[model samples]
Target chain A: MDDATLVALARSGDGDAFGQLVTRYRRAAFLVALSVIGRPEDAEDAAQEAFLVALERLDDCRRPSRFGGWLMTIVRNRSNNLVRREALRATEQIPFSARSSTPTPEKEAQLSELRDEIARALGELPEVQRQIVLLHDLEGWKHREIAQRLGLPAGTVRSHLHYARKSLRKLLKPGE
Target chain B: MVDNGSIPLELLDPGNSDPGHWARFQARVMALAGPELARRRATRPLTVGEVLASWWRLLVPASVVAAAAMASLLMPAETTPGAGIAIEEALVAGVDDEPLPAVLVADQVDEVAFLVAIEGGG
Candidate 1:
């Protein structure tokens, strides 16, 4: 069934319906969480937490078609909250898996640096700006949809995007 | 600034556009959501002990307060040589006059779910 139908059923106390809804959006939700937290385990934890929160408050969802964005907003909020509370703990540096022996260390090192730069740029954006960038550019969200999901005016979404881009531009400038 | 039908590519394009980014992100997402897809029901079933343990968290505190209230009721008059406040007398009398309330099973079930739900994943 489509997400709207599942959501309608879910609202009526159907855990099955809610479960289907979770399956439908879990990918986008996980990615959003990962994009923010940069730690796979923490991303998994935050995404799961977001799902639990969504299940409890399923009735609060107004437009069922907006479920994907709504679910994503939850993960983003949770992941950012996790990062904030953990004080980032340490820089999240995703090391190459020991199981992989394909790429040379030089190539792996460059990739790791790229990963760090991308994550650092993402981390430094203001909350609103970070969320907009992640949802729109990384997550392929449309502006109108983000505005609706976030309860921000369309203009506000655009403004956030503008600032987010400017900040990223400065961060990714050539040579440090 | 070249605009594609009023869409600014600079604004619209992914700053580090690798189109592959979405692909990898999607792959990881699918992996995460895979295990819990079909097993959505709360069917593991809360054991009686589990239920009571869950309930006791709230029940014990509420019971303590209630007991204290009941003890306060039965307490003797404070004005008398050994009597405590009227509230103490009434509290004791109330408990003695009545047994602890029924377990309130339905409300307790709801209480745990409500707690877990609002707090999100443990």
Candidate 2:
């Protein structure tokens, strides 16, 4: 079902409908939070908190059709708050076994290393670039969709994405 | 800008690699939000008809009392008991045939003389 239909059903207290919404937007929410907070664990926490907040303030959502954008805003705000609260903290290393569920230990280690490397590279980019790259490439959102949701011009989103990818490539391949 | 399909950015997304993780995340959110959703359902806004239906008991008696009061106010004053008697008394008093009696006039003079004596003493 579309976001509007799901939102209406959820408003009527359909737990399953809300669960579907959570499932649908969980990845995007996580990516958005990660872009802001720069930590997977904290990003997950922020996303979870954002979902609960959205549930509480669902009635205040004036436009049910644009639920994704509203939820993204909540995720971004919550992530930023988390960042501000822990400004002096150091970045925690991503645990290989904790985040990876590959069939083999060797593949798990490799995937974890790649994830960490990409995350580090992403961290070096500007916040908007991180958001645009993750939403566009990782989350597979169209450029126009990202522009509309982020309230930026389509050309700006494309420019940011181009620069973000270029930076990531350079950061990842400095030896080359 | 055409996206470079070669970046393998999907490696950074754990949700796709580990479905169980995302499942747990969704389950956790639903568990935490269940109570709030129930509250929303419980406190949903009532429709106009529902509001009227719920308040009919109080509204019915109040409407009856209001209607009775309006009817009483609109009724002609002649229907009331002693109303005609009061009008007749006023008309008779306006054009009475009797002259003042000597004893009653003497009583009035005595009251005025007593008040004047009290004021003089004070």
Q: Tens-digit lDDT track for model 1 on A71-144? A: 87788889978888777565755421112224548865665455556556656776667667767775677899
Predicted structure 1, TM vs. truth:
0.49
Give the alpha-carbon lDDT of every model. Answer: 0.63, 0.81
- Cα displacement (angstroms), candidate 1, residue A175, comes to 1.5
Score candidate 1 by DockQ.
0.01
TM-score of 2: 0.67
Name the 10 consecutive residues with the lowest summed lDDT in model 2 chain A. A93-102
Could you tell me the lDDT of residue A95 within candidate 2? Answer: 25
- Binned by DockQ into CAPRI classes (incorrect, acceptable, medium, high), candidate 1 is incorrect
* Residue A146, model 2, lDDT: 88
Measured over the true interface residues after superposition, the C-alpha RMSD of each candidate is 8.4, 4.5
Instruction: Give each model's clash number.
Output: 20, 0
lDDT of 2 by residue, B4-117 (tens): 435667776766577798888888898899898898778777779988898997889999999999999999876656646675467668665553343237655576666665
